[model samples]
Target: MTMRSILKSWVERYFSDEEALILLVVLVAGFAAIIWFGRMLAPFFTALVLAFLLQGVVSALTRRRVPHLLAVIMVFLAFVSVLLTLAFILMPLIWNQLVGLVQETPRMFASGQGWLDQLQERFPNIVTPDQMQSWIGVAGREISQLGQRALTLSLTSLGNVMSLIIYLVLVPILVFFMLKDREALVGFTLSLLPQKRTLLTRIWHEMDRQIANYIRGKSIEIVIVGTVAYITFAFFGLPYTALLAVLVGFSVLVPYIGAAVATIPVAAVAGFHFGISEQFVYVLVAYGVLQALDGNVLAPVLFSETNNIHPVSIIVAVLFFGGIWGFWGVFFAIPLATLLKALVYAWPRGLEGRQTSQVPPLKQD
Candidate 1:
């Protein structure tokens, strides 16, 4: 056969193969590269999340006959106002708690040591009082060293601070443009795609719906959890209820394990005042009940019919990202997973070969 005929035969054989293993490998590698790049640009990802969240508010205002520019300004101003109000209400309480904790640290340590001694006497096989004291001292020194290193690193990064300010300034500018011209921007992007992939437009809309629902529902859940936490703490006469509630609210931003982590410090502090057996139990019960309510009631009510990610997937994502990138990773894991799922569901094969559901069309503004 001629060289041209042989080449045609080879091309036909390659195209006829159903596996496409090499193509799959290339696609996976490209995806990994994108995820690595995204991880490196974590702050930008955060800004994008903030933008998506504010986009809805901007759209709502414009739907009420407000101009896009005015809506953007109003939403931004409202966000700033809420932050300022929260700061005004909670900062003093936090400062007072910090001051009190500082003054009482030594006494608290002494009390803890005494408790250790009692425990040691009750169970001689466990750690002795002297060993416990030595361990505490070592821990204190290590924590001090860590703090000093962190402070030094912060002071050395004056340039980072300036860059952060620039990024903050640019975020609102980007957000404003995105909110005002979102439809145009999306249309432009979709236009760049091949005509064969027109179905992807529906997928994109579905992804947007998932993200928006998740954000709105999570916000409502966080507020509910925070309110419940504050009320419960206040009812039990826990100190720094406002501060702890704030911590709880922020922790709820993370998916599975956050509530447990947030409960630890609060329970420890309360234990110092009310003794571990009594106060710790109360705090534990309160937190457990709150978590139950959140998981069983609030989550179902708010996030029903939304993204149905598995608990195992949530835990693995949290551990993987949290291990690699610390707190921000854990906090963003769900949204990132949701975005990936949406993209996967958009693929030609569809999500795990299941028929993809259509998202409701975007309503006119």
Candidate 2:
């Protein structure tokens, strides 16, 4: 076949199906909207996600014949309670720990410098004075920059406080309404689409369960992992336990990348405070154990096979979405990738096969 004929055949083979054409258009439009208005629509999207996450519990309650309003109220109350706890209690603790870590910056640098100096004295040829001085200079510059950035961040946070307040107020309200009107909203959405939406229905059926399970499971994983990390760090008397624990907990969002990145701060704090002491070793061991359990045990139980995304696909999604939408992008990367995968595989082919199948076979006279 000619190139033009091949192109025509391919289009007819797929886009000729009205359902496939409509799905393709909807997907493209949705993807474009997210890319274009992501930051502007963050709170709405956040509320939508939270409602979906809480829907499972809401469903369970309804199944037991609990009033829908009561179920929504109960779930909303619980969500508000958790949000307030994090904001007023956990956040303050983490903030204090961060302040302490920032204050201890000089001591960490001095300890590191002293260690480097000792190495230079003990191995003059391997760690020459010039090399040590050059290394220290670079380190000093980096430390200075870090401090400046931290100071700038603190100043800007006051401004962000307004935005934070807006989110806190807006998201809950949006979530409550979304939860309360879910059925109406779903019906209205369906009304906007074609009635014969087999492919769309199939994809939604699959994605709905998977996405809910994923969001809820991830929330649980973060809490469990963060709590474990805090307890372990506190038991080992490591500095900045709250702050580091929060990082460790949220790190699970990006799978492999999060755990690896979180290790740096934990190890750095332990090393700077205790040098090569038994305490450092103990802290190290405890941290390793926590990560091991999270990956090998907690993850399997909580996530099950919900997120069967490939590791490579996950990393690429993280990098791509993260670049576009920052942290939220990274957080939702796996699910979005899975959604894309589902769309691609579930997309209907053209009517050629059906037409061929319906045609009568040649009669043998």
Deviation from native of the Cα of residue 195 in model 1, angstroms: 3.1
Scored by Cα lDDT, where does model 2 land? 0.87
Per-residue C-alpha lDDT of model 1 across residues 123-174, encoded as one tens digit per residue: 9888866787788888667656655665575467666766656655666566
The segments of candidate 1 whose C-alpha lies over 4 angstroms from its true place after superposition are: 1-44, 62-70, 83-107, 125-164, 234-237, 277-280, 324-328, 339-348, 351-365
> lDDT by residue for model 2 over 2-109, one digit each (tens)?
999999988887787788888888989987988899789989999998898899999999999999999999999999999999889988898888878887887888
Q: TM-score for candidate 1, please give it.
A: 0.72
Best by lDDT: 2
Model 1: worst 10 consecutive residues (lDDT sum): 14-23
Q: Look at candidate 1 and give me any clashing residue pairs.
A: none
